[model samples]
Target: MSDDVRNIDDALSRITAYWQPHRLTSINDYDVKVVKIHGEFVWHDHPDTDELFMVLNGELIIQLRDRDVVLGPNDVFVVPRGVEHRPKADEEVHALLFEPKGTVNTGSAGGEMTSPLRELP
Candidate 1:
């Protein structure tokens, strides 16, 4: 990918799996990843990195340690690092995730949803 390219639509189509992220673009040490998510995700938190979730389609409910944030299309929220969270959607949801380059999706609690590394589809 070229540094000048920033077409999200083109990046979305290239993504091929659930929970898996396709590197879209990067700003300094952070990278944006386009992901397609459905159902429920495991509860976890990144001890040293904040996670930004931007909904592109459908809806999502982010369950936090204290409250839940409902997100619709174009809605965005950030889960601060070390704050436990779980993402759920009644139907298929497309979202753009932003975090530092080496941030893990499932944080320290590696399980089924954890990807070895972020890759471009």
Candidate 2:
């Protein structure tokens, strides 16, 4: 898609699968992505890139090595590079992610939650 206004709610509504990230747009060397998720994600660390997680719906708890950060709708948290963490939710949550292009969902600790990049819905 070309540069244009985007409604994250509308974009999030179109997602059909959990944990599958759909790239919404790109800026410079980063890609903006949205995904639907629930439960706990694998513990991983992006050694070279920080990850932004912005909650669009529901709630999420980012479990860090030292503590947990709780996020609700409209909340945003940045997990620093090389900081091991895991995301967990009791119910389904919709969220946006901003990180460098090619930053995997599971980071360097690849696991079942690792997702292939997908075109925007």
Candidate 3:
């Protein structure tokens, strides 16, 4: 995307991979990204930056050690820095994520689920 008007839905439509982040744009050093997620993600936490999740479609459960924060379409949640979170979905979920550039989806717990960042169209 150029330095022009950006529609979140339009950007998300270009993505076909689950658990991978496609960079939508940058706000300072942070990357605005869109991703499709299914099943449960690894439990991890950003040691330096807060992670933002905006549910655009379907539902998401931000499972924490003590509680779960459920989000539906049009809902937003911020997992505070250093707090553990595992994003889970029973079905497909489309979401917009905002976090620092180079932040991995799996945090420090690298595994097969880890994906290299992809540029947005």
Candidate 1: TM-score? Answer: 0.91
lDDT of 3 by residue, 8-119 (tens): 7887888887889898888888888889989999989888889999999999999999999999999999999999989999999999999998998888777888898898
10 residues in a row with least lDDT, candidate 3: 1-10
lDDT, ranked from best to worst: 2, 3, 1
Off by over 4 Å in 2: none
* Top-TM-score candidate index: 2
Q: Whole-model Cα lDDT per candidate?
A: 0.86, 0.91, 0.90
Q: Which residue pairs show backbone clashes in model 3?
A: 1-121
TM-scores for all candidates: the values are: 0.91, 0.93, 0.92
- Each prediction's total of clashing residue pairs, residues at least 3 apart in sequence or on different chains, is 0, 0, 1
Model 2: colliding residue pairs: none
